[model samples]
Target: MNAFQTAAERLIQADASHTPCEPLRDLIGEADQIAAYRVQEMVTQARLDAGRRIVGRKIGLTSRAVQAQLGVGSPDHGALLDDMAYADREPIPLSRFLQPRVEAEVAFVLDRDLDVEMANVADVIRATAFVLPAIEVVDSRITDWDIRVTDTIADNASGGAFVLGTTPRALSEVDLPAIGMAIETADQVVSTGAGVACLGSPVAAVVWLARALATQETPLRAGDVILSGALGPVVPVTTPGSFCARLSGLGQVSAVFTQGEDA
Candidate 1:
């Protein structure tokens, strides 16, 4: 098998065995981003063949500081499947993830398809039906989260699951770049940020994603939920508990992590 195929199989096996594998950067090289994406495509196809339904897409590394840290000028994205969705306050079993972390962000549910060439921020806004406060539960199949840009891109951008707020607001009702966000675990606020932390604004991130995906011929479609990058820092969830995030003007959402199914 080719290196890309080998990398994809290793990641797939990691997910199945619940054991984090070594980084793919070693096999694909640190700068070969195109090869990294090829690995992601292979893994995505494997999941689709296994009957997982695609629900949407997720933008990652939206924070400029994170971009610099990862040495990438643009954000990366991954597919969102039906199995990776959890309702607000729903009990999410901890066993499904190897090393889980959570981030607060805004979610846009598209009203129309975003298949146009060179989509702009205006196009994204026009296509968005509503926005919700969201929490992206991120996990890395790479051991100890030892990922560079290429490594993460190949692991489906480290997407695990997402919980969205019940209430939705129109684009006109809120300021996309000014909304405040805070994530807490019943005791205290762990992380806080504003919409501006996400590539200037979440809407702008969606525009980037639209253009990026359109180039790959997998354009965003109506009813697809887009998880814009994190508004603040990514917090690690090491224990069984609940994390709730509140977005000013967008209500709140919760992710309850339980030890197991019977917990």
Candidate 2:
């Protein structure tokens, strides 16, 4: 095996074990895109072996600021397991994550496949069954996100968990771009954004995610839940309290972080 492939295997082993490893020792930096992605493939396979269901996928770096910060023009993709998904308004424990943060989002539940080479935004709308408001709970273990973009990508796009809200809308009725999100905590409005914040529109983000996944020969399936990444600002889920986000026309979605296992 090549050096990157070897390092990639080691990195997968470290994260799967939840055992810390010297970032440089594993040499994740040496991994190419395929090698890095292989780490995720292995990690995800382990999750599957452990009985985690393959629920869907997620689109990351949809936010402009995040894209700029990561030096990526578009976004990256990650897998979502059944265990990693939560019902809207569910209570989550802070003890379950390395470091969790929340953000508002637009989520799509697909009714049809969208792997066309020239798939347009309208194609996404038609293929989708329902659109809902959501809050993505992102967790990173790469030491304060103090790593390169490649590192995060190999680490499964920093994906941990996500919550999709109750209210669902037909793709035909709502305007994706103009859908506004009100993200708040402790009675203070932290920040706000719309679907447009996600690469002009969440549909565009979904398209990018689809195309990228195709390169890996991984197809987005029907009934798959796709989180269009975070809109507005991301807030740390440190303190125990109620965290909520309301998307205009799409209604509300929330998660409560309690001190102990309220599961």
Candidate 3:
């Protein structure tokens, strides 16, 4: 196998076995962002060949805080597979991840194809069928979360799984930039943020994602779920517990994590 393909296979194995691997940069000698995304595509294609369906996409690092933490100035993305989706309040198996964390988000369900360059917030709102509350379960396979932009991009933006809320609201029903989120564990409210924390607004994040995909000849399709990064700080899934997120005007979504059990 070529270097990229070999790296892709290693990542697939790492994900399947729930084991962490050395960063791709260490293996491939300082791969740039372009090279990392190429590895991501290769790995995603392998999953497709294995019968995993691409249900949607996820944007990461849209929050300035997260970007600063990761030392990146721009957002990254990953493909979302059908198997990675969960219903609200569903139990998530802890054994399926190497290391996991959860973050609250606003999810956009698209109603039409968005393939144009320079998409705006209005365009995104127009294209979206509805917005729902979501929780993204992010995991890292690059040993100890020691990752650069390239490292994460190649690891499918550190995506693990996601759960969607039952209630979906039209954009007109709520102010996108002013929506609030409270992410709580069983004990206390762990983190809180507003929709503006996500690149000013979640719709703006979607516009960025749509334009990014359009440049690569891929359009945001109808029925696709787009996660608009984190609305608050990400919390580590260190113990088994129920986690819930309440979004202003949108409703709530949650997930349970259990040790040594299948979800």
Per-model TM-score versus the true fold: 0.98, 0.90, 0.96
Cα misplacement distance, residue 115 of candidate 1 (Å): 0.6
- Candidate 1: which pairs clash? none
Candidate 1: where are CA atoms >4 Å away? Answer: 261-263
User: How well is each residue in 1-263 modelled by candidate 3, as lDDT tens digits?
Assistant: 88788778889888878789888886555537788899999989988998999999999989787788777788999999998999998888888888899999999999988889888878888899999999999999889998888889999999999999999999899897898999988769999999999999888889899999999888889889999999989999988888999999999999788786554
Minimal lDDT window, size 10, model 2: 22-31
Cα lDDT computed for each candidate against the true fold: 0.94, 0.77, 0.89
Taking the tens digit of each residue's C-alpha lDDT, what string does model 1 give over 1-263? 98999999999999999999999987999878889889998999999999998999999989889889999899999999999998999999999999999999999999899998799988998999999999999999999999999999999999999999999999999998999999999689999999999988999999999999999999999999999999999999999999999999999999999999522
What candidate 3 gets wrong by more than 4 Å, as runs, is 28-31
Error of 1 at 98 (Å): 0.2
lDDT of 2 by residue, 1-263 (tens): 66555545655665566553444325655435556676677767777888888878888877777777867676777898887788976777776666678888889999998776666777787889999988888877666656456666676777878888888899778888898888888999886888888888888888877777666678777899999888788888888887789888899988877778524
Q: If candidate 2 were superposed on the true structure by all CA atoms, what would the RMSD be?
A: 2.5
Which residue pairs collide in model 3, if any? none
Best by the TM-score measure:
1
The runs of at least 3 residues in candidate 2 whose Cα sits more than 4 Å from the true structure, single-residue gaps closed, are 1-26, 261-263
